[model samples]
Target: MDSLNYLYGFGNEHQTEALTGALPIGQFSPQRCPYNLYAEQFSSTAFTAPRATNRRSWTYRLRPSVAQLGFRAYPLEGLKTAPLNLVTPPDPMRWDPLPLPSEPTDFIHGITTIAVNGNADAQHGVAVHLYVANQSMNSRVFSCADGELLLVPQHGSLHLDTEFGQLQLAPGEIAVIPRGVKFRVQLLDDSSRGYLCENYGAALELPERGPVGANGYANDRDFQYPQAWFEDNDTPHQLITKFAGHCYLTELPFSPFDVVAWTGNSAPYKYDLSRFNVINTVSFDHPDPSIFTVLTSPSDGAGWANLDFVIFPPRWMVAENTFRPPWYHRNVMSELMGLIEGQYDAKQHGFSPGGTSLHNCMTPHGPEAEVFAKASNDTLAPQRYQDTMAFMFESRYRFTPTEWAMQTPLKQSDYANCWNNISKLFDQNDKI
Candidate 1:
């Protein structure tokens, strides 16, 4: 793999050109662009959105996007969207990792939706999917029209070739491809498996630092954006788009990744999870998980999130006189968690790396009974959690499992048994 160049800073207005002066110097669009390249504007937010929150980009391509045409419905099973016509029971759920493909399967063909919430047409909530692929998308490209894609790779490395440029992601890294951006995935290993979040809300932004000040938790400089790179191949290609809860295929006479130059903040970007400066409680009690949020899609309601991407990276714990592991609780926000590398501290077993667990709104969840018993009797010395990377997709709306997810053998039917062994320990005369 070639070492690619990147532009830095989160949400920075970046400019890059593969050829000298391919980008117009004076303004975003001029009457005639340099090298006679066509200028097109890609908007990720509404035109009337506030300046601080607006996201748009200008691309100088070999040919305008309009030239690529001819779209037809492409039926793809297992890939589902929001507002599914199904009922969701208020039960905690868990699943083993989707096994890798036995046959040759590309990223586009390996996606299987697990659960979804809110409405994609209304532009809110998210859909969770798992991808397992053994092949790369060589002549095929994909884009989502309904939402931005947040990819969390759990098994192998991926080489993403997009219109903007290329990004390489491994197990401990994440990448966000903006809505309507064309890209193809190339596996760097023999097989790959990971979790994907389709966020149909406002574009994700770095959460405000609040009293933690301006420096901790996903700093701006850590986000990496691809520099301009393009292929001028004229070979026939295919474009698969997920639009309005369905898949559409378009035949392209040539490669759509022909952008010679691009300048904007709306392109796909990646961040190393290890770069996240974790902020936590060093004094007494556990802080809300919001402290670990790397990015968030805000809703209309203040202090409420359409979706939040939070992580539980390896960190030290020093909270005295309190249970070190997460406590039992019920929450209004829905939570879907995935393990990236090692065992999650909450579950001693069954919750292996690449596995997933869901706790919908008001669904009770926490450490398993075995974990609780051990934590209760263990010493209170400060401990460091090592070799673990657990993360959660938290949302304001409840999740509805898809038919495939509910019927799949990977669904752990005995998930609730983890807490069944908790014996009653309350005593009337031994109250603290």
Candidate 2:
């Protein structure tokens, strides 16, 4: 993949065209579009949604999206969604990385759901999946009507060709494709492994800065959107759509990415995790993990989120007379964590790159015995945490694991034993 140009800003109504005078001057849909192209409105939110949160785009393409043929049921394996039918156990779960495909596997087939929460039909919660692929979607395009996709590459790089344009993504970076946007994923390496979050609730947006003023923690200007680019292929292609926990296939005479120009705020965007300005304590005690949230999808209840995309990036640890690592405590929000590169300070072992761990809502989970002993005895000094990037998909709703996830050999049965060595340290006489 070549070094491609990108449009900056998170939710800006950007206007771009591949050709001159392609977009209408002021109106979205004019009586006649420039160059005899058809105008189509792509909406990700309700028509009557408030102007502040509304997300819609106007595309001028060679042919409208309605030109595609009828869709047929296409049964895809491994992919699953909420509301899951299985009874969810409260046990803590951890798993090794899903191995790469031995045979040819594209982005769609490579996806395997680990856990899910809420319901797709009801438009809430999220689906957590692991994607391991070796091949690219050359003649195939996929769109999800159930939810938007957040891609976090953990192993190799990926080149995405979407209706909006092209984006180059890799580890240490993340990308979000809006719900119902057609796109293709091309591998830039022999094999790729990553985590995918299918957000079924409200679209993810930058969390409110609140007392932090208007800066720090995933600034809006760092978000990179794709510029308008299209292909005019007349050959046959496949459009696979995932709707209501099922897959459907549609045949088309040409590529679905025929939009010559577009103007909208609802489009795919990518952000480098390194750009996140770390906001930590210079005083004492570790702050809440919410401070590291990159994006959030809020639920109906105030202060409660349907899903929060949080990262534990490399930052300086300088809390006077306090434990530098995370403290031991159960949470109301369920957490599904994945390591992108180095060791998460809380769990130095077992949690490797691409591996996953789940601490369901209120389930007892904290630093392992080893991490606990080390952090408790280590001196408190200003230390730069280097070579680590871990992330979590935290949700208000508890996630139910899929059958494949429970039965897979990668599931670590001995994961809970890591805390068995926690000896009783409650010496009442030892208090200073």
Off-target runs (Cα >4 Å) in candidate 2 are none
- Cα-based TM-score, every candidate: 0.99, 0.99
Candidate 1 Cα outliers beyond 4 Å, as residue runs: none
Clashes of each: 0, 0
Task: Give the alpha carbon lDDT tens digit for every residue of 208-246 in model 1.
Answer: 999999799999999999999999988999999999999
lDDT of 2 by residue, 1-432 (tens): 448988999999999999999999978889999999999999999999999899999999999988988999998889998997898889999999999999999999999999999999999999999999999999899999999999999998999999999999999999999999999999999999999999999999999988999889999899999889999889789999999899999998898889999998999999999999989999999899999999999999987999999999999999998877889989999999999988999886788899999999999998888888888788987899989999999999999999999999999998988888989988889985
- Model 1 lDDT on a 0 to 1 scale: 0.93
- In candidate 2, position 273 carries an lDDT of 99
